[model samples]
Target: MMALRLRAQHRGFHSRRPSRARDVARVGRVNPPAIRVVAIAAACILGLTAATFPADEVHWTITGQNSVTVDWRGGDAEVRYGTTQALDRRVEAVAPEPLPFSSRGPFREAKITGLDQNTLYYYSIGGGPLHTFRTPPPRGGSGFTFYVQGDIGGSLDWKHVAECQALIAEGRPDFVLCVGDLTYGNSVGQHAVDTHFNDVMRWSLDAAYMPAWGNHEWDKPRSDDLRNYKGRFDLPNPQSSPADRRYPYTGGGEDWYWFDYGNVRFVAYPDPWSGAWADWAQRAEEVMAEAEDDTAITFIVTFGHRPAFSSGEHEGEPELQGFLGTLRARNPKLVLNLNGHSHDYERTYPQGGVVHVTAGTGGSNLEEESGSGCPWRGGCPEPPWSAFRAMHHVAVRLHVENDRIEGTVYCGPAGGGGSNTNDIACAQGSVIDSFTIYPYGLKPGAPKPPSEEEEEAQAKKPAPGR
Candidate 1:
């Protein structure tokens, strides 16, 4: 694996910001041209090169209970797992499947499934040192935690992203809900996409990252990034959108996927522009509606690149509005709806017993809360539906317990650069917002584990599709 290069954190030099008033004044006095020249040199130094890729760049994903999907860049990849760090067992190397429309290598996936539940497993990829992940206790068991964020990318705000990722590493969530836009200015080609994946590779140490497709993942003209997303990620996407070809500006392939982890049912929807809206909405409705009757699922968490409800400059989407309407119509007690694209943090009131949250401020330049329809700032009054909104960057931490899921939005510093996870994740300091989903219909009753026949049938049954 290539060395983890954290921008602005090189070892030879100490990087510091103007912390004092006089220092800030001195920084203000610096010429813009000098800054641009230094920035250009730094960018050129970090420019994407095939040499920067790990000989065996690897990452992991959670497909289902006791199941994980390991994807690597280099071919002829192998994985080893056992109860201990010294892996005594090995899964033979397997060839990757080629993309449907490209020549940029193949999607190498090795699935480690059918393991014991409520147990920790140690594993390694491509002869790397062993890493660890725990099979979540069967749905509704205690001690469950997860982080949610989106619009996270590399190259632009490397220091900020690194700090947030470090915070998540410390929390050690079972899995990460990466709503969408996992890459940005760094997403130039397939290799760049993989490099972007490797940027957050540290989070995969203890948590399986489950990501969705965002608009930025679609590179127009050639659409190589779309091919890269399909070729790089092996999610449990039983649903397919054939009408993806109808969208002229986007690329397509199994962007919508879902999985059950712990007591939560997670669904990842695609960017609306990529395919048929009607088809996508119907699929979303089915997923949410079906959860209403699922007693074992104590919480429902759905995410995507764009938010169905937001208060940022984007102000949310009508497509999501209709989808939420459908979900409300079905009366499923959804715990949280996670989304990105607004570049800020926002939470909606418990309208019809569902809370909608937007945590798009992951490393991207913060978008001021100018268009959330607030009448003022600092202590503004949001509309009846919007509970909280902020322009600062934040990542949402959800602590799922028996009857309630408490959430804390860890706000980052004034500007991008950050030093420690403590500042990025705490009840004080940068932490600004918090919310809770009480024992709504979803979490009230004691969980009854889904029957074996039902789980088996659903696994074999295809998700509703167009």
Candidate 2:
């Protein structure tokens, strides 16, 4: 098989950082919502080739107010950075870190500390081109935009993933959530590892990313597991890993973890394919119990690779159903749930007021809402819970704020101009689904199920208009 020497052509990098509220301290604590989103669209674009040498394989991760991790291809070099475009200060250069077993090349990492939140900074590795990333706002900031994506970086999905990456860069979210399935072809091998990183180098370097394991990452010892997943990214709250469970079974992220970005608290569960649902459930219960008094937490959100509720062809996950059901029992007013794996875009009606969203359209082939039936223990159907389902390659965008949180599902067309610039880049396709969440006085628990007699009485009652 002939390898494709990848490259994208574009001018100097562009960044539209999130505007921090003047009173960041006061804004983030509002008892209302998380992130505010204006609109959603998925305009597909291809032909993303633009960049010079040295900068080609550079990217940053684990970015917070006072810390950041930069990974670049070079012999051995320290990082130099500062607030201005010209990097005047420099961190002592260090030897290149060992690459994942299957990966090849002299890639190194530099951990830079002492940064201010909501401030824009520029840095370069070993005197390379100046790259930029904005750290998330302090604990309580009005809220900012973040992107959630999954099921990308495969042979067939390569171009689409690259395009999606381009689109992501265009948005310049404060941070991003990678919902697993980083790469498909030999996820841990040299070819797959290199391809995956290079594909996103265009945009990933501009935004901080938090990665979750997917079925493609597999279940193995933490050191050698998930191939480059662990090797690539880190989270702000790494110690909150729920999978540790006194035993700390490090197979694909301790099976679960949680972190607070700005005012939102994000809880991620283990991949259903990893066979770690038991751990995830335990963790979910623990967090919910804590949520009752955790005033620091403005929003309680959950994420994972498989969906307990989906209207696609891929089989459903009973574990997810059990996992989320636990949250419902514990925290009925759960704000949101993000998921992927069933390559399609799906939004479920608020089940007792929590939105469960499936966003597997991150460059994978779209699964049609066909009659193929989902193969879960009970089976999958367009349950009354399904609000919308579409077969379009797309990405999920969320805007967080103090009082109200909004979400938009953007679907790209089956075909469009093959370029990642101009209208194609900002192409806001029609919004297929959108939802809002309120944090203040959210019901503590699910409403008691109506009795059969009460249900009959309600049914006998006249309609709203009547």
Query: Clash number for every model?
Result: 0, 19
lDDT of 1 by residue, 1-466 (tens): 3211111111000011111121111111112257756864675698743333443445677666677667765444567776666767667544444342332333456777887766777776655555676665776565577888886765323445656666666666777888776765223333335445656776765577778776666534344445556655677755666444534324344668887766677777766653445566777777766776777776777787776676554556666677665665454556577888766678888756668888776554554423434412333556678887766666688888756788887766455232111212333235688877865534446453343345677799878992
Candidate models: Cα lDDT each: 0.60, 0.57
Measured on C-alpha atoms, candidate 2 has an lDDT of 0.57
lDDT of 2 by residue, 1-466 (tens): 0001111211110011211121011111112122211111111133222211243355666545577776655333666677775677777534342244434344556777888766667776556566676665667555588788877654333446666676676666666787876665433334554566777765666766677776556533442344355555545545333342322234534345676667776778776432356655776676765664466556678887777777664545655676676566556436688887766667787665567787776664444422333422223445677886665666678888776677876656352332211112224455656777666325335354443345678999999997
What candidate 1 gets wrong by more than 4 Å, as runs, is 1-57, 93-95, 98-107, 156-159, 185-192, 219-223, 246-253, 369-381, 416-429, 441-466
- Candidate 2 ranges with C-alpha deviation above 4 Å: 1-57, 63-65, 92-98, 154-157, 187-190, 219-225, 239-255, 273-275, 288-291, 369-381, 415-428, 440-466
Candidate 2 C-alpha error for residue 254, in Å: 6.1
lDDT, residue 368, model 1 = 45
TM-score of each: 0.74, 0.71
Give, for candidate 1, the lowest lDDT window spanning 10 residues.
6-15
Q: Model 1, 359: alpha-carbon shift in Å?
A: 0.7
**Clashing residue pairs found in predicted model 1:** none
